[model samples]
Target: MNHTQQLVTTNPNLTHQNQVQTYNTLTFSEAWEFFFQGKISKDKLYSEVRAGKIPHLRLGTKILFRSATLETWFQQQELNSIR
Candidate 1:
């Protein structure tokens, strides 16, 4: 199988996690991966930011997020589902 196919078939979850780890607010790719993990579509991410559902910091138009915040958000989602 091709490299991309091999990656997809083996530990798909890990692959995604790795992608998420590769970036932060300092890198666009990392930010995209984090949003992707949250299952937020690109359009939806923008919309949520616009609507104030998702909190972000703006440094002269550069958006940033804390990794811990994303982790907490995911944990809260899990907790809500358990109820």
Candidate 2:
């Protein structure tokens, strides 16, 4: 799986050591690892994704996820369960 690069500033105070940190939005497997605390099987995760129950993105033919957004989705799911 390929990762999309994200540029983030590490330190704003240090001008001389200014550097941009590169991060990859989570892959399908990596993202699923956080889903339901990884209690579900990979096949089940894929099924959920296919059923549109989980949030994900398709870049061309590649499935990907934004960890922050996915986490928020999970939080909402938890809240819904409570209600």
Candidate 3:
């Protein structure tokens, strides 16, 4: 009946919650501010989202962009720009 035993004997949702905590999702505005900075303007960011070129998650009316995926996209963009 200790802490470890209590967690092991209890609800499984706690593990799932911990899994979810590891991922970082950002809003469109936050994603641009954090990742793009001076590289991409706000207008272009919204345009890409509207054009469906950006990877995103739609939850109800809100949009979320994954930090990892956005970083990958930025790397791709850099590669493309060199060519």
Q: Using lDDT as the measure, which candidate wins? A: 3
**Candidate 2 residue spans exceeding 4 A from truth:** 1-24
Write down the TM-score of every candidate.
0.57, 0.64, 0.62
Per-residue lDDT for 1-83 in model 1, tens only? 65644553465576555544443442333455544555667777777667966557777867777655665676887898999
lDDT of 3 by residue, 1-83 (tens): 55544653365665533432344787776677556654788899888887999888889877799867877887898899999
Cα RMSD for candidates in order: 6.3, 8.1, 10.3
* lDDT by candidate, in order shown: 0.59, 0.62, 0.70
Error of 3 at 54 (Å): 1.5
Give every collision pair in model 3.
Answer: none
Tens-digit lDDT track of model 2 for 1-83: 22322222233453221221123366776565544447888889889889998888989877887766776787899899999
lDDT of 1: 0.59
**Model 3: number of clashes?**
0
Among residues 3 or more apart in sequence or in different chains, the pairs in candidate 1 whose N, CA or C atoms overlap within 3 Å are none
- For candidate 1, the TM-score is 0.57
